[model samples]
Target: MKYTNPVVKGFYPDPSVCSANGKYYMVCSSFQYFPGVPLFESPDLVNWTQIGYVLTRENQVMLDKINSSGGVFAPTIRYNGGRFYMVTTNDTTRQNFYVYTDDIYGEWSDPVYVDQGGIDPSLFFEDGKTYFMSNGLDDEGRSGVIQCEINIETGEKLSKSICIWQGSGGRYLESPHMYKINGSYYLMAAEGGTEYGHMITYARADSVWGEFVGYAGNPVLTNRNKAPYLIQGIGHGDLIRDKNGDWHILCLGFRQIHMWMPYHNLGREVFLIPVKFSADGWFTAGRDGTAEYEYEIKGDFEQKEKKLYTFKNTSWKIDWCHLRRPDFDNYEFYDDSIVLHGSGITLDDADSPAFIALRQRDFEFELSVRLSVDGGEAGVTCYMCEDEHYDIALRKSPEGTEAVLKLNIGGIKHIENTVELSSDSAVLIVRGDNFRYNFYAASQGSEIYLGSGNTKYLTSEVSGGFTGVMLGLYSIGRNSASFSDFSCNYK
Candidate 1:
C-alpha cells in the first residue's frame, strides 16, 4: 500500500517494526523521557494504536538527567521463538541492553547489559543461534559496524566481534539491520549522518562474519539536493515482507521550510515505500525511483477511518510526548480538560516553564485552548526554542482580566495587545504558516496579525537541542489555571 508522509507523527524517531500474532508492532527511541520505548500495535500498518510502554520500572535502566537524544538511541524490536526482544543503546553509559517478553503488552524483562560498545543494536536468530550487530565510531574516528554471536539463554556474547561496514561519504554510519536472503547475508545501514546527508546503504557477505561487498548503488536512497526536496534525510530504515510476500521499506523522513532548519519534531516519521531486488541481489527503494502514493499498500487494501482524540481520556494519545519528564503533581484531569498549576518561573525561563507542546508539521493548523487563570501569570503558547516563543497569556494585573499577546523573538519581547476579560473563561487561537505565526483571540474579532514582533530568534538554529517546536498549554508564576476544550486541527 502507498503510505503518506508521516504515517506516524510527533517525535517518534528511530522506529523499529515487527509483525507478530497477525498484528504489526512498532517501538521507537524515546530519549530521556521515562516510561521509555513506546509500543504501538496495528491490525493494518496504516492505522496504529499505542498499547503500552516497554520501560515502566526502575530496573529497566538508570536514567538521570538524560538530555534530549541522550538516553535511548535506535531500538530494534523482533519476535523470535515465541518471545519478543528489544535491543537499544544507552548514551549515558554507551552500552547495549536487551529486554524480552512473552507477550508484547505484558511486563517486559529487566534490561540485561550486553556490554557492546556502539549505538543501534539489532538481534537476528537462525536455527537456534542468535547473532548481535551494532554500529558506532571506530578506533580511527570513522563509523563502522560490529557483530558477534550471543547466547540466547544468558544474553552474553559467545564470540569475538568483527567490523563489517566502514561507511561511505564523509558522514558517519549507524542503525544497522542484518538479513539473510537467497543464501547471501545482507547488512543494511543508515549513513551520511542524521541530518540532510542521511542515506540508506547495504552490503552483501558470503559468510555472516566477513568479506562483505558494498552494493553497486552504494546509497540505496538519499535526498541530495541544492534546492527544495520532497523528503529530506530519508534513511534509517527497516525492510519487512507482507503475508503476500511483497517487500516494503519503512524509513524516516523530515520536512522543512526554505530558510528554517527542518525541525524533525514530527520526529522521524514512518514512511512505507516499495522495494525491488535485481537478479544480482542488490535492492532499491521506491518502484521507479519515486515515492509511491499515500494509502497504497502492496496487498489486499482496506480503508479505515483514522482515530481522533476525544476530550475524555486519562492521558493524551500516544502520539503526544513531553519536552522533559512531566511533573504529574502540577497537573490534573477534570471533566474534559486539563488543569495546570503555575510554576514559579515565567515562559522565558530556560529550565522551568510549564509548557506542553507538539511538533508543527503542516503549514496550516489550528490550536484552541479554553483557559481560566488566577493569581500570577498563565496561558497557552507555541514554543520553538528558549528564545523563540509566542504566547497568549492571562496574568494578574492591577486592571482586571489582563489578557496579553506576547512574542519572544530572538530574546526580544513584543506585546501585541492586552485586553481585560469580562469573564474568567477565554479562548486563545494560534494559527501557523510555513514559517510565521498568526495570533488571534476569541474576545477580539477579525484582528489577526503577523505576531507583531521579530521572530527570527525563535528558530531552531539558535536553540541547541535535538527537538522541534512544541505547542501546549502552560502556566507561570505562583497562581494556577485550568484549560479545557483543548483541540487541534490540521489542514
Candidate 2:
C-alpha cells in the first residue's frame, strides 16, 4: 500500500516508537504546550490515532510561564516487562525524568528524576538492566552522546556517564537510541541541529559500551539539501521492527509551505521511512538515504485522511491543547459551544491565557467560528507564539461592538482593519494558503474581507521557535465569550 510521509501530522516532533501487545505506540515532543508528550497508537504503521498524552496531569510536567519550545524536549517511549516508560527532558529546568504506567490507557506515575543532565533522554532495557543515554557532557566533562546505567525503579545513576561516539562529525549530536539487532548493539542518533540540515546517523559495537564503529555511510538518512521538496529537517528517529520483521524509522520532519520558499509553519511532524539493513548489519533509510513524500509500504490497511474538523467531531482533551498551564476556570465546554472566561491575560504574555487551539494541519484550509463577546475581545487567532500571530476578533468599541483584524509580528502590533458591527455576535473567517492568511467577518450581511498576513512571518525560520501555527479561539481581558459553529476544513 502507498501512504504519505507524515503519518502523524502537525506539531508533533521528535518521534519515538516502541511496539508492545501487538500494537505500535509513538510519542512526540510537546515543548511548552500543556499536556506534554503527545502519544499515539497505531495498528498499522501507516495510520496513527492519538491515544492520550503522557503528561496529562499538571504535576507530571512543568509549563508555568514556560517560553515557546522551552519546556519539553525530545521524549522516548519504551515498553518493558508489561509496562510503558516515557523519558524526557524539561529544558527550562534542566531536569531529566521518566514516568511509567502499566496500563496504556491509564495515568502515568510521577516523574523519577535522573541525576544525569542532558536533553533527549532515552532508556534501553536489556537483561534485567537499564541503560540511559543523552546528548550532554559525561562525568569526565566530555560532550557527546553520554551513556550510563540507571536503576529503573528510582532513576538513580548506577554508573558514571561516559562519552560515547561524538557522531560522524555533524553538529548538535542528539537523540541517542540503542537497539540490540542480530547480537550487535546499534547506537542511533541525530545530528545537524534538528533544522534543515538534520540527519540520522548510527554506529555499531559488540557491546553496549563503545569502541563503536561508525557506519561508513554516516548520516544514513537526511533531506537537508533536497531543495524544492516539501519535506525537510528529517531526523530524531526511533527505529521499530514490525511483525513482518521489516525495519522502519519514525522520525521528525517539516513540510515547507511552498516549493523554493524555505518556510514551514506546520511544525516538525512524524514521518515513517523504510529502513533496510545490509548483510554487514549497517542500515540505510528511505530512498537513497533521504525521506520522500510518499512510500509504498507493506501494510494491509488503506490510508485515510481526516480533512474536516469541528468541535463536535474533535475531543477537547485529545485534539485541543492550551498554550501552557491553563486555568480550568477559564474554560467551559458543552455539546457544540465553548465558553471562555478571560482573566485579563493577553496573548503577548508568556503565561497562559484564555485560549484553546488545534494545530494547523495543512496549508490550504478554511477556519470559521461564530463568537459573541460580552466584554473585552473574543476571536480566532492564527497563533505562532506570543510574539507572532494574527487575530480577527469582536471587541467593544466606544460606539458599539466592532470586528477587528490585528496583526502582531514581533514588536509591531497593528490593527489592520476594523468593521463596525450592529451586534455583539459575528462570524469570523480565516482562509489560509501557502503564502498568506486572509481574514473576514460577517454578521447579517455578506462577509467583509479584512486584511491578509504573510505566512512567512509566522514561520520557524523567522520566528525562531520550534512550534508551528495554531488556529485557536481566544479571549483577552476580563470578559466572557461564547464560541460556536467552529469548523476547520482542509483542502
TM-score of 2: 0.99
Model 2, 1-491: lDDT tens digits are 89987898888999999999999999998888878888899988888988889999989888999888799999999999999999999999999999999999989999999999889999999999999999999999999999999999999899999998899999999999999999999999999988999999999999899788999998899998888788999999999999889999999999998887999999999999999998978899999999998898786889988999999999998888998899989999997999999987899889999999999999899999999999999899999999999999999999889999999998589999999988879999999999999999988877899899999999999898889999999998889999999999999
The candidate scoring highest on TM-score is 2
For model 2, what is the C-alpha lDDT against the true structure? 0.92
RMSD of 1: 3.5
Give the per-residue lDDT of model 1 (tens digit) for 65-153. Answer: 45445677789999998899999988777879999999886999988877568889999888889988898643344458988888977
Q: Give each model a TM-score.
A: 0.86, 0.99
* After superposition, candidate 2 runs with Cα above 4 Å error: none
Candidate 1 stretches with Cα past 4 Å from truth are 57-64, 137-143, 152-155, 258-267, 287-295, 302-310, 313-319, 345-361, 385-388, 408-418, 444-465
